[model samples]
Target: MTIRMAQESDIPELAQLYQETVLAIAPHYYSDEQTHSWASFAADGVRFREFILSGTTFVATDETGILGFAGIADDGHITSAYVRRDRIHQGIGSTLMQTLLDYAKNHRIERLYAEASEFSLGLFKKYGFHVYDTEIVERQGVEFKRYLVERGVIKKD
Candidate 1:
């Protein structure tokens, strides 16, 4: 698979991937209502497009198409990270995270942070992110828990 900067043309596929991934993974950590509410974010084309363009977004793709994607804003905030449901646990998420981290280091971003869901908590921790806070956030009238995690970008010589 190849990882590259996401193009405007990839939004529709990315949006579908995001929604499918959330719906498929959230059940293990959230209720039906919460999961649907969370997935609803991808339904808003305007917001989704703005999100992809708001920061540096990367997509992983191969013969099968976009397998995963991740994004980090200019201020070092991790906005989105998701792997296709069928492709989870195959290191796609890890690769995407590494890509984001590499980009951060190259851009001199000081720290990286994210509002991570329970499904992604382990991946964040695996990459040295520490939970600084936890919050109950509401999405479309459904509430759920999310972890606020951060990791300093350590430049390696």
Candidate 2:
């Protein structure tokens, strides 16, 4: 597998996989309405384009298509990271994270954080991140719990 910088052309597929991830994973913790409510149907193209075009985005791929991706904010926050939901548990997320963490270290970032959904809680923990706290938010009478996790450990590339 090869993890490479994401190009603007990769945005559409990334968005599609993100939708698939949201749709497939949300229901494990939320209601159907809540899941669909949180998702957009017409394709949220602008945000994806902006993210890929902005500063730092990485895509994991093999002979097939995009298997996973991670993005880091300019300020050292881990903005987004997701593996194809079905293709997870094969260590793609960890690899993606290590790659981003290496980038952060090279750039002299001290800490990185991400709002981890329930599906990702354990993975973050495996990477030595500890949850500072959890936030519960209600939307349309449905409640969601998200973990605020941070890790300051740096790894050399």
lDDT of 1: 0.94
Best by TM-score: 1
Give a tens-digit lDDT track for model 2, residues 108-141: 8888888888888888788888999999877556
| Model 2: lowest-lDDT 10 consecutive positions | 36-45
TM-score of each: 0.97, 0.87
lDDT for each residue of candidate 1 in 69-142, tens digit (9 for 90 to 100): 99999999999999999999999999999999999999999899999999899999999999999999877778
* Positional deviation of residue 79's Cα in model 1 after best superposition, in angstroms: 0.6
Error of 1 at 88 (Å): 0.3
Least well predicted 10-residue stretch by lDDT in candidate 1:
137-146
Backbone Cα, N, C clashes tallied per candidate: 0, 0
